[model samples]
Structures are given as C-alpha cells and as structure tokens.
Target: MALNIKIHKADNRGKADYGWLKARYSFSFANYFDPLRERFGVLRVLNDDIIDGGGGFDTHPHNNMEIITIPLKGALEHRDSMGNSSVIREGEIQYMSAGIGVQHSERNFSDSEPINLLQLWIFPKTKNTKPLYDQINLEGKRIQNSIQTIVSPEGGKDIIKINQDAWLSLLNSDAGLKHKYELHKPDNGLFVFVIEGETVIGANIARHRDSVEIKGVEEITLTINAPSKLLLIEVPED
Candidate 1:
C-alpha cells in the first residue's frame, strides 16, 4: 500500500505581511521555519502571494530550476532579461526555465487592484539547459467542473511546456463533484494544494492553504464541498 499523508486545515502556515505584499506559505521559508514542514518530493516551494496595487517584486535571479507563475486576480506585468515583457492576466500561466541564470521582475499592472498569484519552483533533473519563457491561457473551459490548466509537460492546446516530466492542473470546482487523477507515467507522484473553499481528499478534509502528498497510488479522488479552486502538481516521486 502507498503512504497517505494528509495535512489538515489549520492556520499554522508561516505568514509575512509587508503591507504591500501578503504571503502565506505552507512550508517554512526564508524567515519562516517549521522543522516538521519544509517541502515535498521535487516540489520545493509554494508561495501564495498577494501584491498590493502598484507593488511587485523587483528583478531577481534564478538558476537551474523551473519557475511557474499563476495569477488568480488582476494582471501582472513581467519583464525578463531574455527580453520577454508582457502582461499576464487571470486565467493565464507563465513558465520560466531558469536553466543557467535569468533576471526578471514582476509587478501588479493595476494601480487600484492587487494581484493574487501562486509561485511554484520545481527542481530539474539536469541543470543548465537554457533560459526560456512561455505562457498559456485557459479560459471558458471546464475540467471536471473547474477552470485551470495553465501548464503541462505535453503542452496542451494552449498551455506552456516545461522540460521536466510534470504537469499542473487547476480547477474551479462545484460542490458534490468528484475528480480523480490517475497516474500518467511511472515514477511520478501528485501534490494537491487547496486554493479556496473546502475539499475532502481520501479520508481527510483540507481547507484553504492545506496540502497533501500522495505517492504510489494509481489514482485519488477529490470531493468539493463548495465552489472551490485548487492546484494539482504531478511530478517524480523520487
């Protein structure tokens, strides 16, 4: 049997309020550290950030990793050293491959509206490929009663592609709807993050900011209790 570890709904996640930026992390990061909770599998970081109007993170450098950005509300203005500058709105996802090294900046485009986004970083199998940028939009489509799929490995109809053997699925779910995720490839595992509302995973319940790590299972089920949203990442278990 595979291991089933469920993280319950709790307010124990580390929080940092900078007035302009409000972030809640499930794992200890930077100034926030919980010896019990750090990271899971190849999924290293999950930062739920809310940037205030006209506020954003300045240029930063990253290397030898896959960085994904998903904006849930408002628009984000992005500029990279690779000469990629664009505006990402809700329903859109951006994937940046920091293979060697890259410098970038992210800012909320609206002066009166803040931007809510989730930034994820995954460790790559091999480092130093090449720095790249791409994005995809998922709008007006329902997947298992939800709306989301901004990134995938196979490069869906309009999704951005990454080098790693991983996939990201987002859903805006309806109550009573159950969604099952079956393993698509061997040596892979799934990480589920609750973005909004409430949901039940296996025999446990998870609320906002709660997460669960499942491995060696052929498939798992999810039941939404209300109109909710969530992110599912499928990556190598090892």
Candidate 2:
C-alpha cells in the first residue's frame, strides 16, 4: 500500500537552553507550543536533553502517561515516589508508567559530568491504572547491524514493556547497508528518529536528530549512508 509520510527536520524542532539544561523537543513541550506539532498517533513527547553536572529536575507530577528514557552519554540517576532509585547509563533504557498519578525526579548521576539523554512520553492504552517503573541495559543483548526490539506493549524476556499498544526498536547499521522495517499492525503509524549518522528514508536524507513519520504502510526501507544509530517507534493511529 502507498504511504503517507512526514519528515520532521532536526532544525525545525523546538529548542530550549536553561544553562544547566539544553533540550530539543520533537513535539509541544514545556513552554514550547506548536499547534501543528502536538502529537503523532499516541506518541506525545520526545525530548533530547543535555543536563550539566549536578543539574536535575525536582520532584514533579505526572498521570496517565508512559515515560521512557534512553541515555546517550554519561549517567542518569532516577528517583521516584514509588521508592525506585537507580542509575542508568548510555546503554540502558528506563520506563515509567505514570498511571493514576506519580512523582519523580531525574538528574545527571555525576556531579562533575554532563548527561545527554532522550526522554519520550506515550499515552497509555488505558488510563487510571497503577503507576509503575522498570529499566534495562542493552549492553550485551544488542544485535549488531540490525533492528532490535527494545520496548513493546507485550513485554518479553529481553524487551521492556509499557501500558500502551506501541513498540520501540533500535537500529544499528553500517555504511552502505539497507534495512527494511515491517510494522506490527497494519493501521499503526511508524516514526523514525536518527540519533547518529545519516540515512535516507523514502526520498529524504535524514541526518542527526531528524525524524520521518509514516502511515498506511506495512513496511518501509531505510538506506544507511554511514554507520548509524536510530530509534523506531510504532503506535496505534488512535
């Protein structure tokens, strides 16, 4: 089937600089509001943030949302009202289900080193359930030069689970490689974000922080121009 595609350029993202925190948002977030950039399917927020040493977010409240954190550099320390405390580094992924309601705080784990990370918020399939939190490290489990599933609604042995009908995957490919990604649901929407390197999706060349959103397709192809790291997200059209 033919697809409907939208490319979200890296330079077009909303940016914020607070000295200690530097953030680039893929959707409307914080004080950055864009009517045309509210959301894509059920995926709400995608924030690429860099936090200076000792910088952190004070305890904050959230309800009925699924939050995921992926550290790109340094260490991120997480603390929540649910009594969960942990430090996740570059190779780890953290998930929190802010169902019903919850409060949490995140910061650079090191007092002298800065942390760069990506945090995403996805609306749950069902609301008002109990809040939850979980995390995982992809250090030894990563499959080289392939698309590897990291998070999904149906959590598995090596995959983290969230309370949404969504799937998250990581793609690592070498230069001159081509990848074909098949969606789990026919009616679902696929969103691709480039974390490193450059790749061609459809007819567009997407580089660092660029994203392509696709709909009405069962599969899509990606041509990697160089060694690259990418994040793939699939969510229901609802």
Relative to the true structure, candidate 1 reaches a TM of: 0.92
Residue-level lDDT of model 2, residues 143-236, one tens digit each, is: 9799999999899987899898899999988999999999999889999999999999888899999999999999999999989999999999
lDDT of residue 145 for candidate 2: 92
Q: Kindly list the per-residue Cα lDDT of model 1 for residues 156-194, writing each as its tens digit.
A: 687778777788888788888888777677678888888
Worst 10 residues of 2 by lDDT: 1-10
For every candidate, C-alpha RMSD to the true structure in Å: 1.9, 0.9
TM-score of each: 0.92, 0.98
RMSD of 2: 0.9
